[model samples]
Target chain A: MVLSLTLLFVLSSGADGRVMHIKSLFASPLSEPRVGAQRTINLSRGTKVSVVTTQDPWVRIRFAAGTGWVLNAVLSDSPPGKTSSLLDSGADVSLNARKRVSGFTSAAAARGLREGADDFSGSKFRPDFESVRNMEGGYVNPDDGYAYILNGRTR
Target chain B: MKQHVAAAFFVLTALLPVAGAQSGAPALSRARAHQGVISTEEDHGDLTAEIRFGRALAARILGQYKLSADDKTGGYVSRVGAGLVAMSGRPEIRFHFGVIESNEINAYACPGGYVFITKGALSLMSGEAQLAGVISHEIAHINRKHVVRALKIHGGGGSFASGIAAMIGGTSDSSRVILGSLMDRGMDLLFKDGLSIADEFDSDADAQENMVAAGYSPAEYRRYLQKISDAGPGKTTSILSKTHPPLAGRIERLKQREGRLGENARN
Candidate 1:
């Protein structure tokens, strides 16, 4: 009963709207209020958790695994796919804007980035103008990257 | 008596989210559920603004550097980078990793998960670890929102998501006029490498953390720094060196962090 009341008291302390996830495996969680306490559970990177409360470095969170205390360092409010500007940027700024903004280059327009940067800088051409034209994109599978790094080679 | 009353009221408030969750609604916080009279949603949308602006800069940067002729290089860097970003706090943001075909040994990140490394930097990289170091460093910047925070760009105030979204992709004159002012400041940051010293240090430190988390050695980053520093009179060092603190200072800071991280890992 006392434990439940303590939980209640802590929960009401404010830290709402934040739903962060584990950003680093180095995030060691403490069972007690103080940090570096006897490590009870080790959270893997990318584990999602809802922050119930925060106290400096420690945050009390609720997860499917159960409620626990973790460091604020491990948490990030960045929910996946939230940055999809095609969707997330709500319907407010379209009042007087044009339908097509050519400045918004496609991801495939690698050289477009160069040109935009050059134009912004008052037309000082980049050293490798030819190379920029040669830039291209293809079907990139992220899994290939995972295999390379896990194999212990970066390039 | 007042303490009990307040406690009871808070307890009722706290359970509101739990009840809402049960009814199949997104968990509502006390701040959202009970605004009394004022809405705090304005400050909330700032994160959205920061991301949209970062993407705008990311596109501008791509337009400046152009993608490399080697399509395979982007795939390679993307893989290494994705691994580290998976370990970042904001893995939720889709990261578009590309390689720039420049001879300068440099790597930069625009907001909203757009990271780029010049061909020069990639050519000098001996192995995946060094690549991870550079990519992770840039990822660290995006994760920390260093550039956006430096510019003091806030969300809303009539420049809501539509405005930001339109500004990023729309070609309208109004969008350019309004967003031009904001993007112009951001562009200056991009060309001059004008991130504050503190943000650079923070990115370096955080990059190390991301590297280690992804199972690469942070020492490799220090080694990369040493390599460039020793080269001294190279094209790679020209612009990147100016925007950042001295190489010696950065290495020292990393060395200290290495010790702390080691201790933290052990305990």
Candidate 2:
């Protein structure tokens, strides 16, 4: 019965998402956590689990026995047949900006926030730069983008 | 027999995912679950898939940076990163470390014992311990399986699934273009906006513990954070937030943990 259950879990866990191999089990995402301890769930290498939630660097997953958290850094979203080189190159920031502005405008409208007033125009809050240049022996950029915060926007 | 059944039931109950799925279940809830199940001798086969995938991606990424395998600085980074991993108590897993030639102050870890530190980030470290803190924190991300969990929640089969799908539909050269686009998007999410406050705190706590494990003062982790904070706003371009919880909050947390270390510690 134990073997059958384990097999069931193994199969079920991999159905929805890629099976993530556990690298290390350090501290849990709970209060008063400790490190370098052994765990039953162990988060062993080759252990398969279904991703339940994703937010930033943390992911929530369900194993056969239960659900737990995983760091997004440790797992690959290995879309099949993708070239590794293409993924390594930097993303198109200009395209991202267009999408972001549209999203921002929609969100602002939903919240009744004003738009197109140049309220949130500035690069201090955003780290968009053409290239990171080493400036005059200091971390200053002669063409460093200006910093701007939209009125009523939290910086 | 009854006792055995009862014990099994207890273990199962402990292993069960937290119920109710409350949005505000205290940040430490996940850590508690991790602590409840960890034990030596447990099977970790699930981690292998991530390691294999990570190795392939790292190889490709490093190759693009033109970082030679024989580079001394790369070797130094690996040594320091591996040193922190050694403190994790599970020395069976060999950790691979590399320095990515980028001007972004970021460090990340992928499943399967692979960790990378960027030159931009390396240039900012004032001491070996601080670097160790960064490496240890990335290690903690691996240990915690943060990436896998995130993908499952956002959309199963990992983000790499889409990239792979793109590749399968095209030739090698075309695939490379697709892959690069996918990778760039991935980097933006991972480095620029994917990290959460909870994730940051977990890494912070793990770095502190790993520092102690490696025979360094955990307070050194605190000191590095203070230095970064002192560098003032905008000096460090966090892909996450313009200004994270001010240095004051981090200091307070460190003070709370300091009691565990005993007397004569300077504040």
- Please tell me which predicted candidate would have the highest DockQ against the true structure: 1
Candidate 1 C-alpha lDDT tens digits along B95-127: 667787688878877765667788888787787
lDDT of 2 by residue, A47-93 (tens): 55666555433455667677655444333332111112111123222
Off by over 4 Å in 2: A1-155, B1-45, B56-70, B89-93, B153-186, B240-248, B264-267
* TM, every model: 0.62, 0.47
Residue-level lDDT tens digits of model 1 in A1-155: 99988778766643453677665533445565442346556676556777777653356777665666664445655423332332222223222212112222333143222223321122122233223222212212234445557775433
Local lDDT at B177 for model 1: 40
Q: How close to the true structure is residue B153 of candidate 2, measured as C-alpha lDDT?
A: 19
For candidate 1, what is the TM-score? 0.62
Model 2 chain B poorest ten-residue lDDT run? B7-16
Give the Cα error of residue B181 in candidate 1, in Å.
Answer: 3.8
